[model samples]
Target chain A: MKDRVTTPLGAVTLLLLLVAVGLGLSSPLDVNQGSLVRLMFVHVPTAWVSYLAYGGTGLFGLLYLITRKRRWDRLAMASGELGVLFTVATIVGGMLWAKPTWGTYWVWDARLTTTALSLVVYGGYLLIRAMIDDPERRARVSAVVGIVGTLYVPINYMAVEWWRGVHQTQTLKLLGKVRFDAAPIYGWVLLIATAAFTLLYIYLLRVRGIVAARDEAREERELMNDLQGDLNSLTPQGGLRG
Target chain B: MDKYAVYVIVVYVVTLLLLGAYLVWLAQRLRATRNEAGLTEQVRATSTPGNQTSSRQTPGKRG
Candidate 1:
């Protein structure tokens, strides 16, 4: 099972996805929102998984800072990339959900605004990673950004309660009462979708982590070759011939 | 289908397609990297220290 998990997490993710679809379609519609409530299953899970990915990015970033290990940096980058992907999904999903339910595709609601900011901040974090070619320098700078950028997560989560908005309050509150109400079947389906999305994130992260390591190694090799050429060119036999 | 159903289905399709594309891309890259690693190891094993000068030359632009 462990070997299968390591080599074929994507397959496992696909298997789990069957559960998401089955549960989502089998569940009944919301009383108020009608079929529009179906969007909740996809939107909420993508949004939640994006949080999980960003949180992992921050955690790995912190670990990299403490240990000064390249693996942790790679993991952080992998998670951050997944975070950006899911954040895009969340924004798109939210927009679709918003258009039907809220009568508009977007609004200045605190939740929507903060969530957009969260996406932008993490997107910029990736830009920072790309701009710096030196791996260690990139990791160190991105670690700082990764750790600091997570502050937006909580602010985004709390935005609904902090200010009035068209966006509804969170389904699962960190504090205070949980205001979410739906059929037990719907709740279960949403949970399954969340779990499936999280698995997908993990699968993608592993693939990304491997690719990142290989890319970094290739860069190092090329840089070494360049430096070696420079060194050889400086030698008496080579320099005089040049 | 209803308008709301269309929205939901489209959202799901978009999510699945985006993720599926990423997975396919990643799998290709992983395969390429594995092949590159094997080739690198073969070169390292065959090359001798004395032959370093010949190997030091950069490949042609077509490479």
Candidate 2:
């Protein structure tokens, strides 16, 4: 049978995801919010993963530029794309929950605005990559953008606490004192969701790497073919007919 | 399940659909890349005239 945990990294990630889901599902729902609070199981973890993925992209971007490794650039691009997806999910989930709780679909809160800004910055990073034609140049420019865009993740997270914002403060923080009774099953569900999403992320990253490798090989072949054609056309008759 | 049940269901469904679509796209891409890699290998093998004889003579070491 194929190894379910093929790599050490995969095994460790799977374990952590299982733990996270277990913790999330087992934790009882807040007495105030009822079962709807269970959405936090998916939302909070996805938001965390989104930041982690983007942060990873920034790091890989740095590695790509420093080492001039195409693999690093490919991984960075993949991470950023996944980050965008999770960010969208976070925003949508938050909005859906907010409409009922906050009585508004969206609020011009500091945290919300900053989070939105962070999304835009990363979106622009993708656009910059698309605009550049040369692979090396594109990688370099995107690396710079990726590194610069990461500054906003912290800002997005801390905006509510730092400023007067409509967004609520984080309850899962180490320093927070708010207490709420949570169900046991809630933690398990969260753990499961986190595991599933992390696995999905890993699977996508691997696939993206394969695609990038194929693209590089195709480009190299095309260049070689063009060069050969040019050389063939330049050669006169049989040999150098001066 | 109350008035807001529909909204919650809609959100879940939409998220699931998006995730499923992405997975399908990724699978298609993986298949395409594997196919391209196979084709490229085949072309490289056939394009080299000397390799053809060697490949036929030493089937064990071809790969």
Task: Write out fnat for all predictions, comma-separated.
Answer: 0.59, 0.33
Over A185-222, each residue of candidate 2 has an lDDT whose tens digit, in order, gives 55456556766677767766766666777777887888
Native contacts recovered by candidate 1, as a share?
Answer: 0.59
Strongest candidate by TM-score: 1
Candidate 2 CAPRI level: acceptable
**Chain A: TM-score in each model:** 0.93, 0.78
Against the native complex, each candidate's DockQ, computed on alpha carbons, is: 0.52, 0.33
> In candidate 1, which residue pairs clash?
none
lDDT value, residue B47 of candidate 1: 75
Error of 2 at A127 (Å): 1.5
